[model samples]
Target: MPHAIKLYVRYVDAINRRIGRVVMYMIFAMMGILLYSSITKTFFLPSLWTLETAQFFMVGYFILGGAYSLQLGAHVRMDLLYGSWRDSTKAWVDLFTVLFLIFYLCILLYGGYSSTEYAIQYGERSYSSWRPYMAPIKIIMCIGIFLMLLQAIAEFFKDIAKLRGSEL
Candidate 1:
């Protein structure tokens, strides 16, 4: 592989790794919020913000961890035939299919950007009683999708290298 491509892969992988590690802790935050919700509902007036806040944390956790999941090959796949394929054969298939992933992510990112723009323009807020501003989470969603797109491209390059009997 060329030096620049190698560097790109390394950089994307590094960023995702760091972000994933940080995002992993968000599950605990979500759990804490839920626990507080349970406690509050049992003993006192229910908090409107807890449920919505927990939901936002869950969304952030899943979205932000996506690239790292891909990097780790932790995403699900139908393995009826795939599990038996040779490594090079798998690489070829992955290279071809990654194009579809790239295309889909492109569409998703575009839509996410449009929605985010609308949210910012209108100062959108969730419909919940808490009515939190939507821009921050929408922006985070866009960033996560963009990072996933970049990681997909890096995976494509890695597949190419693998087909050539090299690893990136």
Candidate 2:
């Protein structure tokens, strides 16, 4: 609960909040695209871009929304043991659990870089006829993971604050 840590947490929180809010709006766009694609395929010419574009946007929806979901405590957890714990104990449990998230993110970021790099260098595309560049989706995934890592770090600090009887 030093000023610096609080500021860092706020910064990360703000980034996640802004990205999450913006990305959530894309769901409407996705819906419209899907509807348009359905109508087109059924009645008129089949649009090659619609389904693939929808997939990209759907990935954006889930990946970009991760930190927001964490903020809202929307991620599913088996809470039978967690629910009974006291605040400090709960904080301890959370601290431990977030380590796993951190590890996963680190691995994803490291391993994902090669695919992203390949996409960027070669302009990688899907095997589908549309052949949309794959980098954007992969890049978005990395960005989402980075955001989630930031949010997880903030949450870890919050847990520490709870353990120490300090407000963060």
Q: Judged by lDDT, which candidate is best?
A: 1
Q: What is the per-residue lDDT of model 2 for residues 144-167, given as tens digits with 9 covering 90 to 100?
A: 988998899899898899888987
* Runs in model 2 lying further than 4 Å from the true structure: none
lDDT of each: 0.97, 0.90
Q: Each model's TM-score, in the order given?
A: 0.99, 0.95
Clashes of 1: 0
Clashing pairs in 2: none
The residue-level lDDT of candidate 1 at 167 comes to 95
The deviation in Å at residue 16 for candidate 2 is 0.6
- Writing each residue's lDDT as its tens digit, candidate 1 over 44-134 gives 9999999999999999999999999999999998899999999999999999999999999999999999999999999999998899999
